[model samples]
Target: MNFDKTELSDEELSRYSRQILLSDINYDGQLKLAQSHAVIFGLGGLGSPVSLYLAAAGVGKLTLVDFDSVDDSNLQRQIVHREANIGQAKVDSAKQNLQALNRHIQIATLNHSLDEAELLTLMESADIAIDCTDNFSSRFAINQACLQAKKPLVSGAAIRWEGQLTTYDFRQDNSPCYACLYKPGSHQELTCSQNGVLSPIVGMVGSMQSLEAVKALLGLPTLMGKLMILDGYTLQIRTLNLKKDTHCPVCQAQS
Candidate 1:
């Protein structure tokens, strides 16, 4: 549950009545979700579903950061953006769509690139950070910021027929950051623009990220320290244990 007591209005109660009926997430869990704030980076394929689901599920506030604009090619997997918004900034387009989905939720947009300090500053105010970026550089920066801010991070990635999802809860001493999994300069980044990802692959990963984010906010079990890999070609999903790197430059000192 959230630290402060958050009351749900009659309208909110009605809107979230379906989820509230779950045994695991009753009224209290809904309240906790309503009090949580999530910062999402990249408004592309993975971010589309993550932001939409979080807003519809009643996450109180969302800070959307993306420097790119919606493109004709993005419509293939970026469901949150429409053809009409092709020239508009991704963050602005996403914010508009999210507001339409849940008027009660607050949505903020950052349509420019963020440096290390800017990312850290944004993470400090967020309860959790969601990384839907497609590049390694962006992912590394987000990982470092979340680690320093001590905020949980729900990260998802997809390319071609493969996708991966994981969580790093910086509030925990044993949680492994993205750096623990991939050394900063060792791995090459893949992009859908070049590799061509299947639409549903990104959707699957993003949806799971939304679920993990809600679970993290409600103090429930999440994908923390576990990497969930999906092979869209064979439709096989596997979970692997993610260990902390003792020499990780990002989280080793914190540990």
Candidate 2:
């Protein structure tokens, strides 16, 4: 039901044939994915699914950033790492898994946190950045990099059975950047270690993040102007329209 043999090789046509079946994501759309680069921040619960899906979908290049090493605890939800990778750097572990999924694409790893200048440099070559980090500091940093670079950022967060998804298309004149929604250092940080999270909650949110990233890469319209929240306990989801904060310290200057 997907693309026929014209634009792609028999092997490639067979690999992503299923997705190419969609009217909106036919042969041309697959080509877009084949030519794009994505940089992802963090490689934990959320990053696990996001990276895996993007690789499977044939995103041409991926740069994974994470300084943490895997532990026995992460095995429960961080599905990309194996028991053998328990002490390996997260980016290293993730690179192995993603490369194993699709040897045709490129996977690069950075086993360290990026400072502002470093992030901006990485974002410059990236078509989009995915924020799969856990805390506000990393989130705010990634947001700043994407906004400054005029690239799209697909962000997902999950803690204690609740999750949220949103994208900031810095290309848009009035799109609400992440800084408009949450101020840095204003809220106490939350961690899964201190406050437990249901495994599936992160999987759901992270998968949504991957979808948003793909849509942005393809120049397709998505939940660019709304925030989606999921209540894992109740199994209900809500999407709320977001308004740009004219007074937001970070976004205000951009406006």
Candidate 3:
């Protein structure tokens, strides 16, 4: 992607003036962000904030995948949709909201569950894949697809007052896949519907995921093999360095 500094018009300059103020993201960085594309799974709580922030930050293309529709319970954290959006596909609502947030961005909607085949197609065009789904099935599928595609996967989860963020860059050889941290179908887990989640916690984690995605796109250092855990009640954040499990099923198979 070629970036010409003079191509930014006065309107774009004013629009991204605040981002340009940051030394980390000047004209060059903004151009990189504008040229990059991301695929986000799930358009619920975590996905709502992730997509919103990414779109607002002027990512060139965003592809949203979700099989669900708007419900009354989603209004608390799914800020992309409203009361009128009930029964409407979440991806459709998210596309409309994202475009409204940034007209310069291109929005694509996939109103279907991400099976393995669809995952590969999405990752082919995406610079990064974000896992915001609440279930392990979808998360594991995303991880395997990212690993096969050699793409960076930014995964985030939030429940109640706790949130977690991690990056699995399979291109790095030793980075841990999502299955390395948690085995799929090995143990039972609760979903947001069963366990419930705090509204703001979803936003917090989703925003962090967006930040990591931007950093990865800009070639900035990020949490490639580390897990960040946030505690809303104590307001404490912990970073745990995770090593690639040589005996792990997924990573071992890949090796």
Q: Residue 161 deviation, candidate 2, in Å? A: 1.0
After TM-score superposition, the amount by which residue 204's alpha carbon in candidate 3 deviates from its true location, in angstroms, is: 0.7
TM-score of 3: 0.94
- Candidate 3 structure quality by residue, lDDT tens digits, 10-125: 77678888998889999978888888889999899989888989998878889898989899999989987888888889998888877878888788888877678978877977
TM-score per candidate, chains pooled: 0.96, 0.95, 0.94
Deviation in Å, model 3, residue 10 alpha carbon: 3.1
Which pairs of residues collide in candidate 2? none
Per-residue accuracy of model 2 over 1-255 as CA lDDT, tens digit each: 112222556678799999999998999898788778899899999999999999999988899999999999999899989998989999999998888889878888898778899999999888999999998888888998889889999989999989999999998888898888887777889999999999999899999999999999888887888999999999999999988888888887665
User: Which of the predicted structures, 2 or 3, would earn the higher lDDT when compared with the native?
Assistant: 2
Give the poorly placed runs of model 1, Cα more than 4 Å off: 1-5
Which pairs clash in the backbone of model 1?
Answer: none
Give lDDT tens digits, candidate 1, residues 77-155.
Answer: 9999998898999998999888888999889899889999899899998899999998899998999999999999999
Given candidate 1, what's the lDDT at residue 131? 96
The backbone clash count of each candidate, in order, is 0, 0, 0
